[model samples]
Target: MGALELLPPDTAAVLREAAARTAGVTGLVVNIAVGYGGRREIADAVKQLLRAEADKGKSIEEIIESLDVDQIADHLYTKGQPDPDLVIRTSGEQRIGGFLLWQSIHSEFYFCEAYWPDFRRVDFLRALRAYSERNRRYGT
Candidate 1:
């Protein structure tokens, strides 16, 4: 969530806050998960894995063959946090928009016609209710 493919317009302040927040902070954690492309995130994970293995003196073939889901997940920024249970895509858009691509592989998606500003508590409750009704396989 901290790492990004691109930053939104004028995000210096948010970045500063993110830097200051430590594990001891008890307030709401606001992560700016932006400018991220799903494919790019996967590639970045692979790159990190390669670098780590190389640093430990792994051969190229060994690194490639040893790659696994856990290694890539550790490299991902959202590794420690639980993957989202539901994604609310507002403003009438039904697309996934590439948000949390790898992390949200099994999340329930809720598309709303209202914009973020207009998305109220009722909308959120509705999303939760709908998710409760579905039988998720959790990727089996």
Candidate 2:
């Protein structure tokens, strides 16, 4: 996901390093969501779906009639990927601040006081531990 949605100043190098280190790990999928805003993601998804529909020559009324979560999801940037099970926010932030708006309906969160650069192995371990202890209802 390097330089995927970034403009300027955001570290593409860091994203490249991460992708290089984690490429084809053969385990759980990780989404960086870098240079992303939740509303922006949703808008992008919607636009993509609309474009596809238009290409198919579907009328506006027909497209609206058939629009659905799955339809929109298929056009999302993270299409075909499972939604996040856990989201960790660094830099002492307490909120997701619009990370995975549509996809993370039932996700768990782990907030850390350490900033992204300062976040360490121990901090990651603690976040994992926290996630392990949560009682997930998945919208019950």
* lDDT of every model, 2 decimals: 0.77, 0.85
For model 2, which pairs clash?
none
User: In candidate 2, what are the lDDT values of residues 34-109, reduced to their tens digit?
Assistant: 6678898899899989999999999999999999999988877788788999988998888889988898899998
Stretches off by above 4 angstroms in model 2 are 2-11
lDDT of 1 at 110: 83
TM-score, cand. 2 vs. native: 0.87
Root mean square deviation (Cα) for candidate 1: 3.6
Clashes of 2: 0
Per-model clash counts, in order, read 0, 0
Task: For residue 126, give model 1's deviation from the true position in Å.
Answer: 1.5
TM-score for all models, in order of appearance? 0.76, 0.87
